[model samples]
Target: MDCNEYCELLPACADDELGAAESLRLEQHLAQCAACTAELGRLRALRAAVREGTTYHRASPALRARIAAALPAAAVPAAAVPAAAPASRPRWLEWFAWRPAANAGLAALTVASMAFGLTSFMLQDSPQDAMAREVVTSHVRALIADHAIDVVSTDRHTVKPWFNGRLEYAPPVHDMAAEGFPLVGGRLDYLNGQRVAVLVYRRNQHPIDVFVLRGAGSRKAAPDFDSTLTRQGYQITHWQAGGMDYWAVTDASAADLQRFSQAWRMASGGTP
Candidate 1:
C-alpha cells in the first residue's frame, strides 16, 4: 500500500477498526515505510494522550436530588403525577436557578480529574518503555539521515572485528546471503544507555538492523525463543544468542524476521 492509502486508514488502524485483511496490508506497509511508521506512532500517542486527559463524572446523589426537585411538575408524565399535587417546581431545579457555587464546584472537579489523569500517565512511564522508544527512534533516525551504516562490508570476519576495542563485548557476525538476507555492512550506535553494534543486512532492497548488546540473561535455561513487537509499523524481533542480546529491526514481514532469526541462530551455532 502507498503512503496516501496508509494515511487514509491510519485512524481505523489505530482504533483497531480495520478488517483482518485490511489490517494485515496496513501492517505490511508500515513495516517497509519509515515515515508512515513514525506518523502512526504520533497518531497513537495523540489518541492515548486525549483519552487520558479527558474525564466525565455523573452527578452525585444529592446533586441529582436537587436537580430533580427543581424540575416543574408539568415536566413529569400525567400518569406519573399524583392527584391534587401542589404546582410548585421540584427542589432539584433550584440548582439551575441560582446555585452558582455548586455549579462551579462540579466544573472544577471535572477539570482537575482530567488534568490529574493525563499528568499521571505522562509521568509514570517505565524504563523498559523508554528504552523501546529510544530503540525505535534511533532506527528511524538512521534511515532518514541516510547514515544507516558506517562501515560497508559483507565479510563476517571484517564486520565482527570492526567492533574491536569499541564495545566491551564481542558481537558475532554471520552472512545469511543464502537465506535471502545478505550482510550489507555494520555500524556503531548508542542505545539503552550503552554503545552497541548494529549489523546491517538487506532482504531484497529493505534494510534490516540487527543491534547487539550484552544480555541480562534469559529466564529459561537457554534463550531459544524470540520475542516479537510491532511498533508504528516496524517489526522488532529480539532474542538472546550466546549471552548477547540481539534485536533485529526491519520493515520486513514478521515471518521474514522469524526466518532471519532462525537463520542467524543456525549460523551462530546457537539454539533454534
Candidate 2:
C-alpha cells in the first residue's frame, strides 16, 4: 500500500483494530516513511489532547426540548415492520443502499466519531479526584462481585502470602481486630492501569477496600495528613508509605476512613 493508504490506516493501528496481516504491512511502511510516522504522531497527540483537555457540558434543556420536538413519535416497532419493502422509500435510504461496502465504511466512521465525541464528554476530574473516583469504582466492583476477599480469612499471614507470586510487590497485611478494623482478606485488584494488591477490612460492618500499589512518580515520605474525598457516597483516603501508594475506600464516613488510614500507617510503619 502507498503512504496515503498507510496514513488512512494509522488510526486503526493506534487503536489496535487492524488485522495481523494489515497491521504488519502498515508497520513495515511506517518504518521506512518519516512523513507517515509524523502524521501518526500528530494524530495520537490530537487524540490525547482531546481526552485530557476537553471540558464536557450537558445539553441545555432548550436544546433537549428542540430535539424531542423534531424527532418522530414512537409508533410501529421494528419487529412489526413488513418483511418486504414497499415500492416507494426515502430517497436518502436508497442512496445509502447503493454500495454496501461504502455504506459499511461510512457506518464505521460514524461510530468512531460518536465514540470520540462521547469520550471527550466524560467528566474531567483533577488528578487527586480522579484517583478517588477510581478507588470508589474498584471498591464497588469488589462488592458487586461478592468476592472482595478472594482468600477469605482473618489471618494476616494467609492473606499476605496469597498475594505472593501473583504480584511483583508484596503488600503489607495486618490484622487490626484490636483496633476495631479487622482484616477481612486480601485480593488482587487493578488501579491506574496496573495490577495491584488490595487488603480488605471492615469498619462497623462496612467493607473497606485498601488498595496497595507501587508508588508512581512521587517518592516523598507519606505526609501526616491523609486527604479524604467522597465520591458516589464512598469515602476515599490516599497516602504514600514504604514506597507504596495506598487508597482506602469505604461507604463509611470520611472520619472513619481517616481513622482507618491512620491505623494502617501506624501498623505498616508508614507513620512519620
Candidate 3:
C-alpha cells in the first residue's frame, strides 16, 4: 500500500482496530517509510494528548430515562416516528397503527439486521473478548447501582481482611494512595462462574476496578499475558501476576490505566 493508504490507517493502528493482515501490511510500510512512521507517532501523541486533556461525563439516570422514554423502538432509538392522529389512542397502540405496512417492513428489516449483527459478533467474539465485555458491563453496573464497594476504606489492612471468608481465595490487597491509585474499597462479585474479589480504586473521579480471579493459570491464556481490552468506550488491562489474573476496568484513558496497573502490581508484590 502507498503512503496515503497507510496514512489513512494511522488512527486505526493507534486505536488497535486494524485486523491481523491489515496491521501486518501497515507494519511493513511503517518499517520502511520514515515519514509515515513519524506521522504515526505524531498521531498517537495527539490522541494521547486529547484523551488526557478531555473530561468525559456519564449521563445521569434521569437523563437516561428521559432519553429512553423518547424512543419509538428499542432497535432503532434514533428513528423519528411521527405523531399519530386520532382523538383518543394510547401511544403504544398508536405506534402500531401509524404506517402499519411501512413500520412492519422496518421492523422486519431491523430484526434481520440485528440477527446478522449478532451472528457476526458471535463469530468474532472469542472467550477473551467476552470476558472483557463482561468486565466492562460489571464496572458500569456497579456505578449505576451504587454497589461498587462493600467494605469502604482506604487502608489495606481493613479492606484486605474483609474478603477473608467471602471468597474462595485470599486476594492480595494493598493501600496505594502514595502511588496515586488510592484504595476505595473491596466488593465480592460473581464472574467467570465463581465469586471474584474486586478492589475499587480511584484516579481522580474515575473508578478503577481490579478484578482478581484465582486459579487463572489453569485457564486458557490469551495470546499475550499483558494486553489492553476496550469495549463500549471503557478500557480493561489484563495482566497475570503471582498466579492471579487481574483485569482492571476503568473509563479513564489507557495511559492512566497502564500507570495504575504498574503501580498496583508493584504494591501487590506481583510482577507482571
lDDT of 2 by residue, 1-272 (tens): 78777878999776668999998898788656645654565466556767677654444556555544454433345677777854455556544343433434444566567766776556444567556656666676567657587888999888888988998888888888888898878888666657789888899889899888888632322443446777778887778777788878888888888888888778877662
* Candidate 3 lDDT, 45-75, residue by residue in tens: 5566555654434445565445445445333
The model with the greater lDDT, 2 or 3, is 3
Could you tell me how far off, in angstroms, the CA of residue 124 lies in candidate 1 after the best superposition? 4.7
Model 2 spans with C-alpha error above 4 angstroms: 1-123, 217-226, 270-272
- Return the clash pairs for model 2, or none: none
Task: Please give, for residues 139-190, the per-residue lDDT of candidate 1 as tens digits.
Answer: 8878876879988998889888888998888888988999999998998876
Model 3: colliding residue pairs: none
When sorted by lDDT, best at the front, the candidate numbers are 1, 3, 2
Q: List TM-scores for all candidates, in order.
A: 0.59, 0.54, 0.54
- lDDT (C-alpha) at residue 218 in model 3: 24
What is the alpha-carbon lDDT of model 1 when measured against the actual structure?
0.74
lDDT of 1 at 66: 62
**Model 1 spans with C-alpha error above 4 angstroms:** 1-115, 118-129, 216-227
Error of 1 at 172 (Å): 0.8
